[model samples]
Target: MAQLTVDIIRARVEEDWTRIVEVLNRKIALQSISAKGITAEHMKRSAEFVAEQLREVGVDANVVQSHNPDGTPGAWEVTGSKIVDPGAPTVLLYAHHDVQPVPDESAWRTDPFVGTEIDGRLYGRGAADDGGGIAIHCGALKALGDELGVNIKVFIEGEEEMGSPSFIPFIESHRDEFAADVIIVADSGNWSADIPSLTTSLRGNTDIDVTIKALEHPVHSGQFGGPILDANTLAAILIASMYDANGDLAVPGIVAEDPIGGLQRDLDEATVREDSGALASYRFAGTGSLAARMWTKPSVTVIGFDAHPVEGSFNVISPQTTFRLSLRTSPNQRPEEAQEALAAFLVEHAPFGAEVSVKRGENGMGWAMDPNAEATKDALAAMQEAFGVTPINKGEGGSIPFIPELQRIFPAAQVLVTGPEDPKANAHSPNESISLPGLKNNVITEALLLAKLAQ
Candidate 1:
């Protein structure tokens, strides 16, 4: 990698750090949770707010309203630009402004919507998953100013955490706006707080909302206990069949690949246990090394269940049990294919004449980029330059559905996936925070890359 002057850029980023924090704080305070009745007006307000920050960074920015496939209001996006030369290659910086709902607000250390800094980390629901992401872009662009090399396009998505249900239509509606030679996605994470990682592969995701009915209404346990196939019991049986005795997903038809790519990492038991927060006595599930099963294999998890809690004692049996199934597919598979296979498996295995129905939800394809691509080459070099170390290349277990879709949309462009989260960052879970120093360094890295890409 050739050396270029980034000292000024570094100092400039430092100068903007305080304002960046304020942006993150303001963004975190917005309860832009999409799944709930959080109105489109509120979501649009956040998008417009982000556009304000980008304009401060010298980007030509605007708030764009879009609609769903059914023609209803969709994600309100903030699109911005800072084009140095029309002939120069373009880099699209991507991050989402929307966030997940605080399911267990009581578990949070601070108000989940209030961004608080404690012990060097910013804690908030969207701090890392995205509020921090937006701040990073704003800081980097602010530092670069008019001298930024590449043609820049900044896109802040509105409904990413809601599985981006309306994303496909939105992107299609404005395809030319997002056209670029390279895309920098700020939704991924570093391998560790200290070790920077370039994610070359991402897992795909699918969801199924299933309801199992054994009876039309709750039945008395005393009168019909003996041979009763309660909905709850039937649902349990169906879920149990998803995994084999070895605790691996037993479903057929889902694709699996050998975790032997150039970017694969060897994650040992200690690393898995540390990241998972599993108890010391707990044993791992699935065959092969933890990394192989996690990064290169398919897995099924029943994410949400609509049933009675164990806290209250009940004599009546549930008539129907509903569950939200979340399945992670390997990079070798498409999400739609996996979703179809999973739905069939559930229906075929319904126990004891139980009426089973599966409702499929939005699904996304996984992405795997060529490590040999020139943009990949430039990015790896830029990461090493910014972080002052050779970045570790690895595949991530989490799904960023848009990456593969972007690839499908613009096959010629290179997509560099990077982020500020670590194992301790705890993105979706409670106590979620973005590492401050790590965030700053990532900004520097991206700023340097933007400068390099311009050349």
Candidate 2:
């Protein structure tokens, strides 16, 4: 393998961004909401489009489908051509085509289904989250093949937003076909808009719905106030007990370790509040650096609560109340163990005579990359060469369930999480957007990294 020149890679990326944006916009226009998932028609169209583009660039590409157990739309894979060298290390580039649902149209400034460009940012649902990253990877490969004569396989899944339940089965069935020396997950964002980042850890997640039942129906609150058990109040008490005053999770057996350090930065509270749509006075619990508190500690958030309405002022004791609890465990914790601890806490802490039931939802283990891996070194070098800045290693607070599965299947493979997205990309939220500059940088970096991996 020949040494890749940064200037050549940058030039190729500059030449390809225009076409890449067009293709990405086309893909984003289709509503591939994972909650509704990708329709057969939509998947077929997307696959066809990708296949055509690969052929146009004189690369071998094809859409491989894996059927669901019941014979539904199980999973889909798009494989590209190999680099010239027969022994070149195969690199699997992973992205997801599916996105979360757009609940309210009025919440968006532009059509969520339509990709809109405003103030140098492309606005759409999945623009930055995964679409931009996907485009960068595909575009970089295309440009490298045409301009630098390199090749890499591309594997984009359609169920990532849905916890990627189908990914493991797909990988297991097609293990040989998906073999890679390293995997580049371009679904994360940088530490900040300007600073490049490689995510080294991801917290695991578990969902539990706790329901408390006391009375059969709503009774007059004034009359029943004295002794009658209020399900809502009981539920609140149970929920509140899950956290200590310091904002640290009170769940048993879940240890909160100090973050690896160095990822800490003084985040402006005002900026955080504005970005998170919280009041200026809004504050997070726990003591530590923001990054440490966010990515290292266990967090318990009551995502959903079911109770009586405030408008009705229902002077009654509610029969039943339920709250959906989402637990983000530490990087090394097992989600199932966390779930068990949570269930036990809720069950043992329930109010007297109140029936409390805990139902476990989806659970996934966290992922922590080996910092000493060779592939990581190559990736860092590639990023430095492309962006002229060393990449920052950090941890994402959210869970990408499939990462653990991938790690289990390919224990020796190095996994690096770097992408085109940024902090302000508004991923999983309204008016999500991606910076054009970031997209271009990702293309260049990925292209250079592909060359490095091949070497």
Candidate 3:
């Protein structure tokens, strides 16, 4: 075996890129959708598939599962280890095998379960969200074969999209085995196909179910509509109060920051509009830099609403209406505080003396890390060399609850967040995809980072 260098690793990854893509396509075809819970056999098949890939690269791999309160198997996990030296610094590679459900298959240009490549991007249900992350880990392992100098642990989660119900239990059960000096989370996106980035911040999220009741039961609209307001109208009034004139969230106690001076890159407004698929005449919400509005400021969205359908004609005052609010808090704000504040706001502002019931749902804490940390510097340098451009520090509006958990369990470990996704990946949507060139570059970057860690 020869010494591992950036040039050597890049060449190996390029030489074996075709096989890597094939493995990802095979993984994508399993239909391991776990968002609705991990009951499907395909989810286990996905874990076995990841273990097999690790074993191919000389890792001692196994398909493991977390236990429920009654000691029964809950969610599946694939874990493996490859140790070049007993005393060497160990690095853990993290990526999820589970994917979001394909609610509307008719909206897909290509089959959601079939990985199809068109115009240098591979489209599939999990192609970019996480299958690409798995490919990057495997490609790096294969590229650094024989000459690898550090210990590595691979953990491919099987229930992340379903909010990782068994994540904490599993980690606590195998804490010693998986503990490492560095943790590489390959589940975020890059700045662009040509520009690489290291994600350092993630916003937290909490969902609140607000039900407004104005009447005890249905009543004739023609008779009682004059004095008493309908529940629908009251619900509308409460939802409308979430935003101010500038369309920014007016929720009190939620933290917000202007990231203009801190961000390494500027989010182009035109690009945001195009990427969001917004109408030409549509207006954006909030204030400050687009990056700050998305990455640091609080935002509220109505994810689910319940009301009578127009198809069934009804001319009556509704008793109550329920709306689910998905609130994204700032990276530094506590989710509990945000949830309490929003609930209080809704109760205080209840319209027309309507009875307001706020039921709290899922709440996940946000995460933030210094980009100039030792391991992060190595990752950024590797990305810069591999992508042939200066890498940037980025923040994600999406919440990865498990990342914060990882930090809690292994406080000493340096968590470096990187991925193969680009802006156009469209993860979790109809046309989810991963850039082929971008994936290759990510593989090289990981291989270089691993080699650098050994020194």
Model 2 steric clash pairs: 221-315
The Cα local distance difference test for each model comes to: 0.83, 0.77, 0.88
- Global CA lDDT computed for model 2: 0.77
For model 2, how does the per-residue alpha-carbon lDDT over 288-343 read when each residue is reduced to its tens digit?
77777778788888899987568877567788988999889888889899889989
| RMSD to truth, every model | 3.9, 2.9, 2.6
lDDT tens readout by residue for model 1, 1-455? 12346677678878888888888889888877777632467888888899999988898999987677788877888887887889999999999988888899999989898899998899998899888778878888887776777899988888888867677777777778889999999888887766788787888899999999988899898899879967888999999988888888888888776563453457768877887789999988888767768886888888999978889968897889899999889986989999999999999999987989999998878888677777777777767766777787778777877788888888888888888787788888899998888888888888888877877
**Comparison by TM-score, 1 against 3, better one:** 3
Candidate of highest TM-score:
3
- lDDT value, residue 352 of candidate 3: 74
Better of 2 and 3 by lDDT: 3
Q: Candidate 1: what lDDT?
A: 0.83
Residue 146 alpha-carbon offset, candidate 2, angstroms: 7.3
Kindly provide the TM-score of model 1 when superposed on the true structure, using C-alpha atoms: 0.83
Better of 1 and 2 by TM-score: 2
Best by lDDT: 3
TM-score of each: 0.83, 0.89, 0.91
